[model samples]
Target chain A: MAGIIMEIVQKGWPISRIKKFIYLGFLLVAAIFTVLYIVKTNPINYVSDKLPFTLGNEKPRFLFSIYGSGMNGGLSKPMDVTFVNDRIYITDTGNKRVQIFDRSGNSVGLFGKAGNKAGEFKFPYGITGDSEGLIYVSDMRNANISVFDRAGSFVKILADNKQLNKPGGLYISENRLYVSDIAESKVKVFDLNGKKLLEIGKAGRGKEELNSPNSVSVEGNRVYISDSGNDRVQVFDTEGKYINTLGFENNSKTSMFVNPRGIGVSGGRVFVASKVTSYVFALDQNGQKIFTLGGMGQEDENLALPNGMFIDEEGRIYIVDSANQRLVVYQN
Target chain B: MKLTRLSLILTLSLALVMAISTAAFAAQAIDSGPVKGDGRSDYAATPKNTTTTYPGGIYLEYDANGVAKDIHSNYQRNTDACASCHATHTAVGASLLQWANVTDTCNACHDGTITTTYDVVYGDFANGTRTYGGLFGGTTEGPNSLSKHNVGEVNIAAAPGGNSAGKADGFGSEWGKSFECSSCHTPHGQGRNFRILHPDVNGLATINRVKGETLTSPDNLVFSSLKAPWLYGRPYNSSNFSDSTHTAVYVNGVKQLTGFSIDYKTGKVTFTSPPTGTVTAWYVPSFKVTGDVANKLTANEKVTYKEGFNEFCGACHTDYAALTRGDGKRLTGVYQEAYRHAFGFNYSSGPNKKGLVFSNNAAKSMTNEFTCMTCHVAHGADQTWWTDWKTKSGWEGIVSGENAGSSALKRLPNMATCESCHEKGKGDYTY
Candidate 1:
C-alpha cells in the first residue's frame, strides 16, 4: 500500500484534488451518522406501537370505583385497601372505621369505629391481609396496628405507640409483617404474632437510610420500601440488608417522584403511587422505568394523592385514591 | 473532475439527512396521550422541567403548558391543598370535610402528624411557641373549668358585643350559628388578610378598597376621586403604602417617590408640582396583611398595629369596636361612659412606655395601638391560676357570679391584662 501511494504521488495528481477527495469522504461519513442519530433520538421510536403491552406503553383498563358511606357504600378518605377471601377491606379513615366490600363493588359488612377501643381506629392508613383471611391495619394516629378476623370482628392489636410512632403502611408476607413508621423513618419487620424480628433503615438521605418511608412490599427475599420524603425506593433483603435504591431523579434514566406513598410488587413489576403527582409509576425488578398510571385530575382515569395500592393474584390493581375519596380498580 | 462529482454527491446526502432530521424533530412535538411513562413525552412538554421548592421540602412541578400540576400547603391557584382538608365526593361534614366537623378537619394536620409548626390543639409553635391561641379541650385550667372558646359548639349564644338589630349584615345574624374554625379563617386561602382571615367575616366586609387608580387633576397637582376609603397607616397592599408612606405613584410606568402626598382616609393624592405624564396609584382597599405574617415573626418580636384590626373585630363585635375617636366617647345610643375600651390609638409614647404584643414586625415602627389581639387570644385563654382564684370565695369584687373568671380570651387572666398597661389598681405590671 505504501509503494502504491508513493507511485501515485510521483504521478501527476494535483494536491487540491487529493484534499477535495478527503473532504468528500468525511462528509459522506458525517451524513450517515446524522441519519442514525435522528432515528435514535426520535420520541416516536422510544415507545413502539407494535409492542402494545410494554410496561411503559400499556394503558390499564378501568374496572370499577367504590365511594360514599354507610348504606350508599360510601367512604371518607379511604387510606388503604386489601383483597382477602374474595372481599375488599378498606380503612375508611375519615369515618374512623373499616369498610368491607365484595369484588363486584357491593358493600359486604363493615367493622371498627371511632375510638381507642380494641377494634376502633383513629387514623387507619395502611391495610393488608393474609392467606387465612386475617386483616391488618396501620392506625396512623393511634400509632398501632389493629388485627381483625375474616368476619370483620376485632381479633387484637399489634405494635402500639411504644414500638411505633406514626405507623403508615403495612405489608404481610410469609408470616412476617413489614411496617413503615413514617415519623421515625424506619421499617420494622414483625412476625404475625406481633413479635419484632428485624428493623431496617434510619432517618437520613444516605444509601441505607430512609426519609419518611410510606409503604412496604415483599417479593421473595427482597423488601421494597417507598422512601417517600427522599423521593426514592429502597430495596432490602428479608434480613433488613440494604440492596439497592431506585427512582431518585438525580440518577440517570430514572423518573422524579414527589412523595411516593403506596407500593406493591406483582407480576415482576414494582408499582409505586406518587402522592403529590397523583401517578403510579411501575418499575421492573432491576429498577428500570416500566410505565405510569394516572395524573393529577378528578377524571375517572386521573388520581388525587393515591395513598395505598394492592395487587392481587389476578393482576388487578386496587388504588386507594385518598383525596378523591374513592377506590379505583384497574386490570393490569 | 471525478473528485468534484463525488463532493457534490456527499453534499446532497448531507442536505437530505438534515431535512429528514428537522421533520422528525417537529413530528415528535405531538402530544402523546396522558400518562408519561417513558419520560420522553414529559421531557418534550417541559423542556427545562423546573420545580419551585417550598419550605418542608414541598415542591410543585409545572406542566408543559406552564400550569402548576399540584399545590400542597402553599395554597396558590389550582391547589391540591383543598383535598388535604375536604373530600369532594365523600364529604362527611358541612364544608366537604371528611371529618365530622370543621375543628376536626383543622385538628387532623394541626395535631402534629403532618406538621408540628401549626399544632393548634396542643399549641406547639403555632405562634412562635408562645401558645398565643391557647389549648383546646384539656385540663390546663382546673378539671371543671373549660375556659376556652367553644369552637365546635352548635346554636351558641350571641357574642358579647354582637348587635343583630344595629347592623343589617350577617355579622349580627351569626349569633346562633355553629361557631367553628371557618368563622374566622377562610380555609381556601382566598383573603388578602393575615392568617387567611376572611375579608368578609360573618356578613361584614372588614377590608375594602380600590385596587388600582389612575389619578387625574385639572391643574395636575391634586387628584381625589378614589372609589372607596383607603386603610390608614397599614401596609396591607403590595405597594406597602399607608398615610405615613406615600401611595405607590407611577408617572408613565416609572415609580415616583417624592412628588405626592396621600390622604389615606379620603383616598386622595396631592402632588407637589404639575406632572406631565399620567399618574397612577396602586393600593389595597382594606387593611389586609399577606397571609401567615405571624408565622414569619420571632416569638419576642412585636407586631406594629395601625388601623383596620378594630374594624376586623368589629365585624362580629359591632357594638364593642370603637371605629373613631368620637365613637370611643359613647356607648352607642346610651351616650354614657364608653362601654368599650378605645382602640386605634398610638400607644407607643404613652404613660405605659412598654410596648405590647403587636400583630407583626414586618415593616413600620412599633406604634402599639390597642387592637383586639392586644388584650385577647384568638382561639381560647387557658389560665389555670386565674380560674382557680375566680372560683374561690375571695374574688367577688374583681369578678363574680356565673361569668366570674370566664377569661373571655383575655391575654393575662383577670384584670391583669388591663392593669399591665393602665396601672390603675396596681403598679405597672410587666408582660
Candidate 2:
C-alpha cells in the first residue's frame, strides 16, 4: 500500500497537503463570515430601529379599531368600546344601549333602551372602565355621562355639565374621567361626580390644537385625542401640556387621513379609525405604522366607512363597519 | 489604527491560545493578585511556596510573569475530582473536569463505585451497572447499581422508576431535558444551586404564580387554605387557672407559653418579652399569599409558614397521620391525627417488604416522619445527586469532604437541612 501511494504521489499528486490547505481555507472563511454576521445582526441595531416607533417622534399615528355596530340585535351603531376582564363593552348607539360581549364575540349583556331617562340613552358614544370595574358611559345626545356597576345597574349620572356640549368621547382611569366634546373641540376633565376639574384642548386648526376632537385615551399621564377636522391625533398630559401630534400631515402630498376618528390604546399600540378613507391604521405611540389591518377598497379586509374603533387585550381590533352593516373583528 | 487593531487582536488571540495550551505561559495570577489563602485567592499558604517535589514531574505551571503557580485542586465539594484520569486542563467536561458530556459533568468522574471498607455504595450509577456492594452494610440485597446520568433515553417511561411516581432511585427517570453544562453547572460562577439557575427555573415559577390583581374567589380561597393553620389558635396556657390541658402549653412547665394575645388578624407571629424560649409560629409567606403577594409582607413579622402540610407528607410515607388524614380528598384542608397512616404504607415492618400499608402512628411528630426533603431535594442539587439522587453521597444526608462515612453528617454543610424533617418515603425503598 505504501509503494502504491508513493507511486501516486510520485505522479505529482499533493493530496494530503491540498486537503489540509482546503481545511484551513474553510476555517478562515467561516471565522470571517461569523464575525461579519455578528456585527451585522447586533441587537443594538434592532433596538435603534424600534426606537423611532415609540414616543421619540413628532407625528405618532395610532391604530384604529371598531367594536360593536348596529344590525346585530345585541349591539348596533357602537359609538365606543371598552375592555374589562377579557370582555368588550360597546356603547351601542343605534340600539340606544350599551352591549357587553366576551372576547370570543358572544353576547353577555346589554344596558339601556331608546329613551331619554337617566339610565336610558339617545345616543351613547364614549365608554370606559375603572379599576373597580365600574363603567362610565357618555350619553352624547342626552348630554350626560352615566356610571354603571359591573352588573350593568345604573350607579349614577357623572359630570353632567351642560358645558359638555356634543360630548363625542369619554375615557376614565382610576383617578379622573376625560370627556371630549366635538362641537367645543375641547376635552373636559371631571371628578366621578358632576364636577369639572380641568378643561383641555381649545378649538383650533393650528398644530398643537384640537379640531373637532372626537376620541380620548389616557395611559398613565399621557392623554391621546383624535382631531377629526385637522386629520391628526394630538397628545397631551393631564396638566394639558401639548406633547405632540400623531398622524399630522406636513404636506398634502402624502395622504395622512381624510377624517381621523375613534381612538383606543392597548398593549402599547394605538388604534385610529378614519371615516373619509374608510381605513384603520395601527401605529405605535410615536405614530409609526407597525402594520395596517384594513383599508378602503373591495378587499377581504377592506372596510366601508370604518367609523368608531377599539382594541382588546389580545390586540384584536373591533371596527364599526357602518356602511357594511356589520361589526368586524381583526385579530392579531 | 488598522495596524494597532490587528496587533491587539493578534495579541489577544496569542494570549488566549497560550493560556489554553500551556499553563506556564498564563498571565500573572496578578489580577487574581498574590494568592490569598481562601479558595477564591491564588496565594500559596506554604512558606517559600515549595513542597517536596515527587520523582515524577510535579503538575505545576508558572504564569507569564514567571511566578511559580500552585495547581488548582477541586475546591468545590460538589464538583467532580480531577486527576482521576487526565492531567490538569485536560479534563473533558465542564468546569475543566472529567465528564463525558454536559450531563456527565458531575457523574462522569464519579460514574463508578467509591466504596471502600467504611463507605458503602448505594444505587447504580452506570448503564448495566447495578449497585454491586452493599449499602452501609452488605446485610440486605444491594441497591440497584446503574449509572443514572448521561442518559440519552428519549422516553421518560423507559428509564428506571420513570413510571413510578414516587421512586427517585438513581437517574432512573428521563432527565426530560438534556443537561447542558449551564443546566446544572453555571461555568460563569453561578451559585452552586441546582442546575445553575436556568432562566426558566430561577424565578419563573414565583413570577408566574403571582396573585391576580383582583383577588378572585378561587385564588383567595386557596390562599386562605394555606393560612388557616396559622390563624387557628395554638394551645394556650393560663397560670391563673392551672388546667392540665393548659399546662402542656408551657415553655418550661412554668411560664405560660400562650395568649397574652394571639392576633390572627395582624398576620404576624411575634414573640414579646413576656416569655423567653417560647416558639412563635408563622406561616411561610408564599403559602399564605402566593409568591407575588408574599413580597408585600412586612419585615416586622416572624413565624415563617410552609407550603406542605401533613397530607402532602402523607402522600408517599407510611405515616398513620397521613393515611388516616387522607379520606380520598385530594386538596384536603383538615389534618386528623387518628387516621394518619391508613392510606400509605409501612415499610419498616418486614424483611425487604415493599407495599403501601397503614401508618404506625409513631411517637415522632408528623413533620418528623418522612417528608419531601427526606428523599428529594426541592431545590436543585449537584448534577451527580441531581442525576442520581439515590447513589451519591451528601445526597439524602451522606456527602463528601468533612463528612463521608455517615449519612448522619453531611459534607455540603446544608445537607437535607430542609428534608431532615420533610422526609418522604415508604416501604423498604430501593433505587
Top model number, lDDT:
1
Per-candidate Cα lDDT values, in order, are: 0.62, 0.45
TM-score for each prediction? 0.57, 0.35
| Interface DockQ of each model | 0.05, 0.01
Per-residue alpha-carbon lDDT of model 1 for B282-332, expressed as tens digits? 654443433133323234422343435666666666656634333345655
Candidate 1 residues A154-212, lDDT tens each?
88887798998878888988779999988788899999888999899997767888866
Alpha-carbon deviation at A317 in model 1, angstroms: 1.1
Count clashing residue pairs per candidate. Answer: 7, 69
Clashing pairs in 1: A56-A290, A68-A74, A68-A75, A69-A74, B208-B285, B209-B285, B303-B360
lDDT per residue for candidate 2 within A191-276, as digits (tens), equals 77667888888867676667667778876578888876566788998889888877633322222454566776654567777654
Candidate 1 stretches with Cα past 4 Å from truth are A1-56, A68-73, A249-255, A286-289, B1-279, B285-431
**Shift in Å, residue A38, candidate 2:** 40
Which residue ranges in model 2 land beyond 4 Å of their true spot? A1-74, A161-163, A249-255, A266-268, A297-300, B1-431
